[model samples]
Target: TMAGTGAGYDLSTTTFSPDGRVFQIEYAMKAVDNSGTCLGLVCKDGVLVAVEKFLLSKMLVEKTNKRIFPVSRHAGMASAGLVTDARQIVQRARDEARVHTENFGEKIAPHVLAERTAGFVHLFTLYGSVRPFGS
Candidate 1:
């Protein structure tokens, strides 16, 4: 059965009623669900990630890959769909980490990076032409 989209909901990031709900975010989430799979593992030694690779052909030359990426010395992330979007988020995270260390004289912790980046992601869903990141 098909799921019902909420009534009177406008599927645009710029529009919202008094209820303050954005159905466009829901739609973006559904789109993200169709992206590739990515897995992350943390053990005693360090962090490891296994990501899905979609190789088009044997002759396609390798450029910069968009799968696993590093945010800071202590933090990294692996993304599936819209890896370009993920790179933007990662760049934001990296900048935040740098500002944190420059101001506090300490490395940004992984949990802290995650928390701040999550808020950044939420802001994109609330306004502008920005859509949700698939990672």
Candidate 2:
């Protein structure tokens, strides 16, 4: 799971079971300091997630709302912090996966995709702190 803060702040929590089940909950504030909250729940395949807003609106109230975005049919994202940065990262991953599928055909295994994603994230995290703004 990825998380962090921008525009608004979020307090998020998650739980996982030994049987490969997951549960995530988040509380988001409206402004950087407001007191409202929204809730979200997602269950896909064997993964589950839940989010609760604290001070923020449950749904997008502006055209610029970028907190929650769908990455694929089987994947969606919610940001508790650093919403824009996280969304960009997720979007890039989705785009890369799409490009890979277009080039390599759709027969790739889920494990392969997951491994690639892990490698990408690892590389980013490793070099991010040393690089300028982690291009």
Candidate 3:
């Protein structure tokens, strides 16, 4: 059976609208779309990341904001959404890498780190008490 098409469906993260859209996820995407540009490229030697910062306020100090953050010795992330939210994600990623190294006696692989970070972000959308990151 098809679910009802109503605005109420958007209020719950676990509920999908009649068209199969998750409103919370959509909201997060909108936030990212409105933020600074972030991109990455793979070169012959390594990867390169760049972020175009958007200054929205006059009181903000110039050249003080950092959009790229290191998670491990060899891994880092370039973010485009809210700064505080990005910081939380970076911190969680660092912790994940640290814990993986402690338990396995090696650095966390890039794919493993990505999967762990994605799972961590996904959890926020499952509960009503917390909106999805950057949403």
Candidate 4:
């Protein structure tokens, strides 16, 4: 039913198709889904995170690629998608936490930091000049 109708709209995230689908975001989700597996569990002392990444080459060494990145002393991020995009987001999160600490004289709370990071990521969807984040 919805065949060629998605062609023109899929060009930009700011464009919504007839069925109200943002094709760019849908495609980005697909990319993330194929990246790898990441899991987190709440432990007695703190949360534990694990990542399973597929290496593109047999020559590559294990544990050379990083998937979990530290956002702050109390917060971290596990990303599944493009490494560059994940790094960019993580760097932005670090900047946000640093700014919050500098302004408030206290570390940024996890919820507040999440909200700020989400807000920053949402901007890409609102502008035609930017593509949706791969992660």
Best by TM-score: 4
Give one digit per residue, the lDDT tens place, for model 2 in 63-101: 464555665665555554545545655766677668777
Instruction: Give candidates' CA RMSD values in order.
Output: 4.0, 11.6, 4.6, 2.7
Which is better, 1 or 3, measured by TM-score? 3
* lDDT minimum window of 10 residues, candidate 3: 1-10
Better of 3 and 4 by lDDT: 4
For model 3, the local distance difference test gives 0.85
Error in Å for residue 33 of model 1: 1.8
Candidate number of the best lDDT:
4
Which pairs clash in the backbone of model 1? none
User: Which ten contiguous residues of candidate 2 have the minimum total lDDT?
Assistant: 5-14
lDDT of 3 by residue, 29-121 (tens): 777888888999999999999998877789999876788998989899999888888999999999999999999999999999999999999
lDDT of 4: 0.88
Candidates' C-alpha lDDT: 0.75, 0.45, 0.85, 0.88
> For every model shown, what is its TM-score relative to the native structure?
0.76, 0.44, 0.84, 0.88
lDDT of 4 by residue, 36-85 (tens): 98899989999999888798789978876788999989999998887788
Q: Is candidate 1 or candidate 2 better by lDDT?
A: 1
Better of 1 and 4 by TM-score: 4
TM-score of 3: 0.84
**Model 3 regions more than 4 Å off:** 1-10, 16-21
